[model samples]
Target: MDTRCNDITTRNKNEALCNACLIPIKENMRFYKCTYECNFVLHEWCTRLTTELKDYKIERDQLRHFSHRHPLTLVYLQQPNHNADDEDEEEKEKEKEEDFVEEDHHGGQCEMCNKEIWSFHLCYYYCKSCNYSLHKFCAELPMTQQNHPSHPSHILTLSNLVQSRNNFYFRSTDGTWKCSLCNLMWKNIYNYHCSICNFNMDIICATMSEQKINHPSHPHRLERMSGPIVSGCLACGNKHEGEFFQCTNCPTFRINLDCALLPTKLLIQNHTNGTYTHSHPLTLAYSYPHSEIISKYYPFCRVCDGKFYSHLWIYKCDKCRYYVHVDCATSKREPFMSIFLHESLGKTFKNYKEDEHPNLLHCPFPDEDDNLLKHHMSNQMEFISKQHDGEMLNHPSHQHPLIFFNEQTSVDKKMVSLHDPMKRIQLLCDGCVKPITTVPFYMCCQYVDEQCCFVLHEWCAKLPSQVQDYAGHPEHPLSLLPKIPGKFFGVFKCSICELQSNGFVYGCITCEFYVDINCAFIPKEITHDAHPDHLLLRVKPSTNLSKRYCKACQYSVRYSELVFHCPSCDFYIHVQCALLLPKLIKHKCDKHPLSLRYEPVENHISQYFCEICEDEFDPWEWFYHCTTCAQSMHAACGPLILQCEQATYAYDQQSVYRFLNVKFGGTLEIKGHSHRLAFVQGLERDGKCSECDTKLQYEMIFKCLECEFALDYKCASSFVS
Candidate 1:
């Protein structure tokens, strides 16, 4: 061991000493031991400054030290731990006994905590004094090493060998690092550095064992890389060429270090024992796609408080399914049962007399007993039992006295009995069979079969009455009519909801405006495939009508008199097409359902791909996508296309150009015509034909040098064109 200081100092005395701990050294004339970089020298006495030879035991050629309880071995770099010559009979017998002891002591104290060890590792040790124990590898570490898995070529220096610095090489101003170990950047910290690549590893991360590590995400132990690098990270789905945890049993199972450390279970403070569980004080949950029981019961972890659809968990009760994190359970130091119980029962038992209450009659001691708290708790349990008898009083929604109905009852002549005196009455809605509690009941006069069902709330019975200007016919104010009209009807068409007027029809008194009650509330702005710029609007057909088609569902304008039109794009659709609500459109590309969004800004670039044609979308086009799953589809190619009976042609490219020109209300000249033809400015592209002065527009076009066949600006500028 070299004991030398590079700085100028005297040859003898305390001046020439180790920087860590200073001690006087004697001068040596002939013999000298100096640092490689300097000429300073020290005597042998100065080298070994401390006389602390803490006894350490060696097992299987590995030594366990007290200072740091990691496993270590004394071996020269030139000499390997095991010799090339195979072990003889005597050595083999000794090795077998060592292996047996290690295997049988699996349940022994953890070398670090001196507690019973349930998990295993590469090495172990026990401290006799403090009963504190740890692995030998965790004690003595090498000063430097090369070709480590994290860094293939750079040598990692130990903390004791390097001088400390206030600022870390990798951390930002706040001591955070962008290194893979932390995943996120920090402001300040000590870190290992690779000068060549400028890569820095934190001290804790640098010492991480290159072996199986216990993580909360997976049940099986995750091992260090013993095979080829994985193609992608399991958590973020990003391609990577780095160290990752892989399950030995499953080839496909892989996860990054950051994702593996995420907390498994959560205990919600607000939801604990509120709705999910009554017996347990805490509520627990986990992540999705783990265990079938978690998804089936929808158990929430009490630690994180997040609802868990799927993940492995240890719960309080097998019946209530109150799950919690195993680590959280172990670290829980304080009792929460008392606080939770007091909060739940404090208000209900505020006035109950301890002496007179029969539920409190079974108290284990006299009224003045010292264990009054325990007796009070016993009485609270009795109150809870009585409250669980499936009885409720004066629920806010109910008007008359109501009782829990044993069976569905008929509405014919059943009078309320005064002796039972119903505390509440729950009437079922006529439209949706869900029960509605109230006093005054509206009975429907008409019967469906022999059952004269006549009990419902006033709002439920009159729900079919309200209506307004429906469909594209503004002249007709649609209202629910008692009977269907016989005038000018082949098949009754609804003015509100575009569906056939099969049920109760809402008809206009002045004109032939009629629609179903459901159709009256059809929203105006809706997503459509035909016009990309804006949602289609329901309107009466214009007198100057060119051929038009439904932007959504891609159907022909069968009912030409009335249609859904987009003024911005000059797009039109039949009234029936406009009646289709935006929510109904479903795209196959996404697993979750999609919804329609109405965007007013036309400048926003369309960044989605179409599910139907598998093509990029023009920003100006109106579209629909599953909000949750992100599956997108052209409004024209919505799922309702199958229901359309008529045959439809592919969307006309020329019509799009015409619509654009009409919107701009501009004119331009085209080439190869005797007179300059009036054309609207459409989609435009660069490069004029050499033969013609006309600028190129569409991808494919006819060119003539003599005639100069240039496209009009409107025709070339249109996105669809």
Candidate 2:
């Protein structure tokens, strides 16, 4: 026999070789022959032997039945009887009927019995000789199972539980026996049992095969249990009780029988390499930077890119990288996963149109006729021309016929006017209405005479020399003063106008008054209510005893001696007072309560008032008031008051009276009364006034012929100046 492909080896020549048992074949023997080696053959029984049988050294004779303590033997063929009655048709019919009845009673072929039977019946197959049988399906089962390496003793067995105990059962607190696999409890009776181990499985667990099974909750097949029941169910975190599928090598790991068969890898929409960038992992049980611990741990699923609020998570990435919540990343469409473009790529360059370009010259070449350049030059030249024109008029007085002359020709005697040869000469400028200096004088041809020694600028002689109402002094008619002074001259003073004569001066010859060309046309009726007591008087300095301070503002007079003064009250004022315009005025003490009132009083204190907000008072106080209503105020309240009433008023007689009545504790004698009034010291015993509760320092004592009354300084000075 050839031993190369045979399980059993033998040395022989011309022997019909057994391929499996490796023995010489006999003429009447039953054996299996290999197609590749026609001479090779195997015994029929040897080919049917189980793989476990090979390890036991048993003799060929022992294969009959001694190992099983039974009379079982291998039979080659059964002997036949030849009798006429044995082939009876009726008897054969009866036998066939009996076989049919038996098959019907046993349902379909019993898997353990390995025989054909009827269908739709419940009965176990049994052997008549030894009473050993199995269900047809079980009879065909292999001796050992695959994928269940840990449990070697698993075997097929018939379930014989009572009808009441056959249902699914689980343990409960009601003192009942239960089946852990089916989750149903039984209260009354014992039923089917396991012969080995303390674990008593239900009919369901015993019959369930080790194969993938479908469950409604998961989208995968669930495998059967092969080892100890897991304590934690990976799907729900509850204590696992029933049979479950778990990998022993993975600590504390157990998946639902359903989850065990799911595809290991998933392709998620916004995840890469089974991880979501949106959900970076931190250390398990790690504290947050602010010392907060996440109570319910969850990880973002890469597959769905959504947060899975579960405690079991896989964290094996570097710490520096950021991870977004899977749900957040998915909703954002994973914009960070864009393909990077190289900087050198022309596609990255942006193109801009000429109109959109920020460069000054998009065309690169210079064009003299460019519209922008022409516009710029035109604007610049226009500005320069205006500046030059402004410079042409240095002084308003010189605007007539001014001419630049060299100093050499300035002292020419011919430039002197003949009308006033001995009179002091005064020069006039054609340009800015100002007097010309010792430069050469341009004379009018008509006025120039060598022997007459008279000369004047032609333009200066023709220019207008008189003006009507100028600024605030309007009543007086103004005329130009002659260039040469008359016989009586001590610095040419205009007696009526009260202004020093300079260059061409306007004068009211009827009043013997003169004013500079600028002040000649002052307006007579100023719109200011501050000076409403009397019309603003434009007059030069005079010996009038009443003209003291400026009537408008009460400021001391200096250069412009011709000022506005009120003849009625002997008040003088500056012209600028009439022009003051303030937005809002306030006082320090009563900011919100008081406002300026501008109205003329019959006996005005100091002249001038804020007319818009008609407030009148001593001009010494800063005057400002609202222009809406009638309210008088003091400038001292500006520090305290923020808002006030509208109207303004000029200083009234009451203010002047108040000022005069203020006492400095000095002795005062009434002009008409004969007796002298003296300030007497008050009692120093901290006695307060009955009326005002103020500590009185000095009391006034009035000594009269019939009566005497002691009064405070305030009361004593009230009746006197």
User: Mind giving the per-residue lDDT tens digits that candidate 1 earns over 572-598?
Assistant: 655433333334333334555455433
For residues 1-721, write the lDDT of model 2, one tens digit per residue.
2123344433333446443333456666766553432233456654554343423224432232111223222212111223357578877655543433201123333322233332211233344356443333232233223233223353221222212222222324453555545546645322233223323444334445533334323344545564346466664343444457544344344555423322222222233333323222222211122221122122222222233333432222232222232222223222342233111101111222434423222111121112222222333554533433221223243223223233444234644322111132333332212223333344333323332212333233333556656442457645565432431111234332332333455556565555443343333333234433234454555454342554323345555455555443344544333322222333332223233333222123233443323444443333434334333444422311112334322233112111111111224465555566544344333244433455543222332322332344454445553
Q: TM per model?
A: 0.32, 0.17
Note the Cα lDDT for every prediction shown. 0.39, 0.35
How displaced is residue 15 in candidate 1, in Å? 2.8
TM-score of 1: 0.32
User: Where is the poorest 10-residue window by lDDT in model 1?
Assistant: 654-663
lDDT score of residue 92 within candidate 1: 68
Please identify model 2 stretches exceeding 4 Å from their true place: 1-254, 257-310, 319-721
lDDT measured at residue 591 in model 2 versus the true structure, 0 to 100: 27
